[model samples]
Target chain A: MLLQIIVNGILKGGLYALMALGMSLIWGVMDIINIAHGAFIMLGAYCTYWLFNLWGVDPFISLFLSIIFMFIIGYGIQRYLINLVIRATIFITLILAFGIEIFINNLALVMWTADVRKVQVPYGASNFSIGCVTIPYVRLGAFFIALVIALVFYFVLNKTRTGRSIRATAQDLDAARLVGVDVAKTYALTFGMGVGAAGAAGTLWAVLFPINPMMGGILTLKSFVVVIIGGLGTMFGPIIGGLTLGVAEALGSNWFGTTYENFISFTILVLVLIFLPKGILGKSE
Target chain B: MAQRGATTKKLILGILIIAGIAIPFFSGNFIIRFFTNTLMFAVLASAWNIIGGYTGYASFGNVVFLGIGAYVSAVLMEKGGVPFWLAFPASGFGAAIFAVLIGLPVLRLKGHYFAIATLGVAEAMKALVDNLEITEGNSGIYLPMMNLSVKAQYIFFYFMMMGVLTLTLVVTYIMLKKKLGYGLIAIREDEEAANSLGVNATLFKVTSFALSGFFSGLAGSLYAFQQGFIKPESVFDVGVTVKMIVMAVFGGIGSLLGPLLGALSIEVISEILTNYFLVAHTLFFGAIVILAIVFTPKGIMDIISGRKKFGINYLLQNIRDHRV
Candidate 1:
């Protein structure tokens, strides 16, 4: 039983890592918490849902489309809306992101209503067993896909010129400017990349769970817990954080029932903030 | 000339207070209820100003206090058979005590960490209330309706909320002029410097939080009594916190009059939109928040106080200063 639960948690944790990666990247690069991170995820889910329902596109295939769509949206938001207050106090940026969240959520509500949706892929129920441990095929596929994307993200950040420029801008905006980097464009591109990751995560999430316009709020908070647990400024932080949270939450729900799930996540967040303010792997300033 | 300006300000304030007190006498029930709601938000924004604006600790979960106060007042009146008058103050104290307990450890963190911690606290509190038996779990609690006419009840709640608003404003006004206020401002400007100057940062922060809790709790208590029903979702809604933050920021973060102006204007705008646009009100509200933050990040108080010029140049300057 314990092994099965751990397996389940690890599977879920992979996607959680994908979810937090976008938020962590945005926070690390811009020093702004994108409160709309989950909303972007929701949009991605709807995007996948529609493509699958309207044209019978597989979720896996539509994932790339969602990324492209959401990247443009994220890039535009940062360029026009968020860039306007990028240098203000954290509170202003936070509030601005919150406004964006509200706008997107309501817009989605108007467009699609609050009905929960699911991606009914053909292999959704298929599972495999290994030594009394059962794993859903879709889940395993999602896990592999998530890891692959995360690996690609890592490669992009470490091995590319754009990644270098983004890192330089995050490190020192003025120095990057002096080095002929277009700081504004880099910021926008970084935001776009972060949101594209969110879009990819959302497509995977739609296959695993029900999708709705209001699903983003809790996901956003959950990503926060994951990011904070894993620590920031490191590539593998979201992975570590997501696994820890998923395992802990699975254990907690097993012991205390599913009703205590939210409480457990939030308690862990507070405890982490109090005990490990820099997060598990975060470097001290 | 400065003294004359002060007197003029005082005259305007007096007249406004008088008009506020006389509002219910002539206004219809809907208008009276609207004003009461506006006053409640004003109190919330102003209370938030004490910690977020002046002390520079932006609390994202202040609705926890509101939820606590509502539950406390509800349980006292419905289960314990306590009078509203007694239950009201008890609710305030209960929330204040909770603030101190939570604020001690939570306030140790700074900036976004503190804000997120507070948000977690609010969520945790809501979950707790959702599961707890004494609060009746998620089924919610309903208070005994006041045995009075509809008009009388509306008027009564209006006065109650108005009285709380008056108390909040007076307390804030006095606090901002005293040692506590100066200490908090010093902390806001530079916490490390304030600590080095023997400002007792923790005490001031906790005290500010407690005071903020006190007023917000009172507002929640009045809200519970006015509505006659309380639920975890209704009282502890994060939307309330968002509204408070938006109002406080819209008017001005650190000023005494900013939240009041913000609440009044935002509420009025919201009311108008709700009446006319109905389904799109929230969308418009969100758009307004975005525009307000982008254009006037310093807030309307900046323009009113003449700290910023009201022109396209000022708007462009703000964007230039803040944008990448």
Candidate 2:
């Protein structure tokens, strides 16, 4: 029973890790909390839902389309709106992002009518059992995609020229500028990539769970919990954090009832924030 | 010139105070209820200003105090057979103690960490309240309604909320002029420097948090009694915190009159928008927030105080200062 629970947790954790990746990038690079991170994810899920329902495209095929569309929107938001208050107090940026979230959420509500949506793929219900453990094909597929995206994200951050420029700017804005890196463009690109990751995660999320405009709020809080537990700036941090939270929440719900699920997550978050400010794998600043 | 300006300021203040006291008597029930609701928000925003604006700790969990206060007062009145007058003060005290207990450890963290930690606390508290048997396990609790006429009830709550607002403003005025307020401001400017200058950062931060909690609790207690019902969803709602913070920011953070002005204007504006646009009001509100932050980051107080001129050049300068 425990093994099956753990497996379920691991599957869920993979997606949670992917969800936190975009938020972590934005936080580490721009020093903004990106309160609108989950809004972008909701937007991505809607994009995938529309593509599937309208054109009958498979979610897997439309994932790339969602990413591209979200990237452009993300890029524009940062370049035009967020950049205007990028240099203000941290709370200013926080509030600004919050405004963006409110705007996006209300817009979604107006357009989508607060309807819960799901992606009904052909193999959504197909599951295989290995001994006593059952694994849904859709969940397994989502997990695999999450892993691939995380790997690709890690590679891009470490190996590419644009990645190098992004790192340089994150490290020292003036130095990066002096080195001929266009700081504004680099910031916008970083934000775009972060939003793209959110879009990809949202697509996978729609496959596994129901999607709605209000879903983003809890997800944003959960992503923050994952990020804090996983540590900031490290590639593997969110993965580790996500898995831990997933397993812990599963165990907590099992023991204390499902009503305590949020209670458990938030309690863990506070304890972690107090005791392990840097996270489990984070380095001392 | 300075003497004349001070005299005029005092004259305006006196007139506003008199008008505030006389408002409920002259206004109808609808207007009285509207202003009372406005007063409640003003108190909330003013409470938030004590910690978030003056002390520079942007707590995202101030609603926790509101929830705690509501529960406390509800339990005291309904379960303990306490009167509203006694239950109200007890609620404030209860929230203050909770603030101090949680603030000690939580205030150690800085910036976004503090905000997020507070957010977690509020969520955790809501969950706790949801599961607790005393809170009726999310079915919520009801307070004893006062045996009064409808007009009398309206006037009673209005005066109650107005009195609380007056107390908040007066306390804020005195605190800002005293050493404790200076210590808080010093901490806001630079905590490390304040600590080095012999200011106890932890004590001051916790104290400011407690003060903020105390007033928020009072507001919540009144809110519970006025509504005659309490629920985890209603009192602990994150939306309440957002409204208070936005009002504080919209008026001007760190200023005495900023939150008051912000709360009054925003509440009125939102009410108008709700009446006219209905569904699309929030969308417009979101846009207003975005435009306000982008254009007037310092808030309306700066413009009113003439510290920042409201013009094209000023707006352009603000953008230039912060834009990438």
lDDT of 1 at A279: 91
Tell how far residue B179 is off in model 2, in angstroms.
Answer: 1.5
Question: For candidate 2, lDDT tens digit of each residue in A135-242?
Answer: 998889988888898899899999999999999999999999999999999899999999999999899998889999878888889999999999898888889998
RMSD of each: 1.5, 1.5
lDDT of 1: 0.92
Using alpha carbons, what is the TM-score of model 2? 0.98
Q: After superposing the true interface residues, what Cα RMSD does each candidate give?
A: 0.7, 0.7
Where does the lowest 10-residue lDDT sum fall in candidate 1 chain A?
A243-252
CAPRI accuracy category, model 2: high
List lDDT for all candidates, in order: 0.92, 0.90
Give the poorly placed runs of model 1, Cα more than 4 Å off: B1-15
Over B169-263, each residue of candidate 2 has an lDDT whose tens digit, in order, gives 99999999998899999999999999999999899999999999999999989999998999998899887888898899998899888888888
DockQ (C-alpha based) per candidate is 0.86, 0.86
